[model samples]
Target: MNDIRLYLFQSGSQLCKVHDIKMNQGCGQDMEIPVPWFLLMHPKGNVVIDGGLAAEGLADPRGYWGDAIDAYRPRMRPEQGCVAQLATLGLSPRDIRYVALSHLHCDHSGAVGRFPDAVHLVQRREYEYAFAPDWFAAGAYARKDFDRAGLRWQFLDGEAGQPFDLYGDGALQAVFTPGHTLGHQSFLVTLRNSGTMILAGDAVYTLDHWNETALPGLLASAVDAVRSVQKLRALAERSGATLVPGHDPEAWRRFRLAPGYYD
Candidate 1:
């Protein structure tokens, strides 16, 4: 039997309103939401889904983002550092064997430098976009941290239909669920005691978004995003796997949280 146990680590949480942006669901009003990033642990090994915004960026505004990053100042905080949270659980950065990123967004890839020894897994197309961003806007990718850490990287180049099995035993799988970004992906983790849990990265940011069939303002392609959500919802229904959204406030309350960890 696979003795797998899962842990939900709240690397960080942010409060933001929909009206903060120019696009407000076409209703000209704002909605309050809690944004959260998480980490998953298994008996076989620990895998960090997405690294939350780093403390450095939250501390000195002039250091990381001079003017372009000022828009997010109100919602970001240093108290939710992922590295520090890991220490609270008696697990160091070295304890993580794999760092599976949903995409290369600045918020999701902030603390990647914390785990230097782990193999950083990402889709090939996503890495390509991060390296050469001329096709889209520039500075969308943060490459400095990965370069600074001298971390080893692994690229998933499989076709969209087939899922990439990280452990080769069907215990942990990375599913290609692109939309918000070109190479965006989600993870389906099978636990021995808890069945299957699907980490729906930014593909489905919140359950409300899924229910309403609404797309976030920042999207590579709205059509693709909708399709990815349909696929995720179908998979979750067929497999009976608990779908965890990337930024759902109720995720911590609905699912089990790691001891001493708070959202």
Candidate 2:
């Protein structure tokens, strides 16, 4: 049997102008971007990547997101949280052995607290930046999502060229892809039947961004973003891996969701 399987879950969707995701274009165009998370089922353990909206955000947007709620209108339901979605797959937070966050953005790490037993992996800079006093001043990184006590935090050192092997069999690997955030990362999963798949977690919002080199609506460094895209492009081309974007509505529709999986 294949040692691992992958499932896609639609945690929530947000309404934002096209410019909010792709810079200098789609200024007046309104679109709904789908927020997705992945569940990697391995023989040894389960890995959760980029947990989406938590029950709190779906409960109260203004209370959780503040004034930014108007610009990035996040529409979520309590049932859409990671825990609830996992339950649909006959799993729960307790089943997850590791939670690898792409970045500490509010939308991505919202449900992290649900998996306190899992080893949370994040880049050193991303962890520090998320806790920096000025970090919350921008209101992008929500404290409630990550400040939970008793949660196991594991910092991944990119400077040492550490590519985290999720199951120690090289089926899943973490790829450093920083641009949208200072220390963001993507995932590369080598499946038995589906071949190689690179889950581009906000590294490239949509294929448009990957194709046209259009910078994301919000970026920490444009230069870094372009470089990251180039790296992912090269990796995909060389390995013939399918690139799974972070928040592309069109791309999201193509994936087979939980209960149904790619093995």
Candidate 3:
């Protein structure tokens, strides 16, 4: 029997321009996309993959995100925050043993601090970049979301340390997939009956980005982005794993939500 259960949760939704998600495609078109976070319930310990948007945004988007709100407007509900979503399962931040972050973007790392007892696993380069990002990505990283002194962190260097198996088991893996950012990563969860799942963080934004029809918006490196997308695609195809894209509204609808889990 599979000892792992995966649950999906939406922290909120963001209304953004097509070009904002996919590089230079839909200019004036508006798209409302779901911001999702995940939890993996394993016999060993629980892990949170990305924490979704910060709960503070629900109170005041402009005040929390500053000028960045103009580009990707947030529409968050009270029950959609990370804490609230976990509450439905009778779980809390303290219950999580580890937080495997894909990157340090404000949306992805917002609730990370709440898991004070959990070790925050991130790429070393990403850690450095988030604090001192270039002018182009200056608005994306909100330091306040993850800059707590007491929160614990576990850093992975490069490929050598990565595809890091959480709990020293083959069940959960942190796959280094840099491109969307300097230290971006993706995750792989293996279940006995439900098969394997590839959680493509921002590494592959949507099917358009996955299928190579369009590149993702705001690329740190176009070459790296393409390589990472193709790499993820190949991995999924080779292993017959379900590849879940980041910020895909259509994909989100198809997903089995919380209360319902994949074991």
Best by lDDT: 3
Model 2 poorest 10 in a row by lDDT: 133-142
199-227, model 2: which lDDT tens digit per residue?
A: 99999999987896578888788888888
Report the number of clashing residue pairs per model.
1, 1, 0
| Of 1 and 3, the candidate ranking higher by lDDT | 3
Better of 1 and 3 by TM-score: 3
Q: Candidate 1: what lDDT?
A: 0.69
Off by over 4 Å in 1: 19-35, 66-68, 74-79, 134-140, 158-160, 250-253, 260-263
Give the TM-score (vs. native) of candidate 3.
0.96
Q: What residue pairs are clashing in model 2?
A: 21-217
Give the range where candidate 3 is weakest over 10 consecutive residues by summed lDDT.
158-167
lDDT tens digits, residue span 118-237, model 3: 989999999989889999998888888888889889999766744888877778888888899989999988888888899999998999988889888877988898888888888788
Rank ordering of all candidates by lDDT, starting from the highest: 3, 2, 1
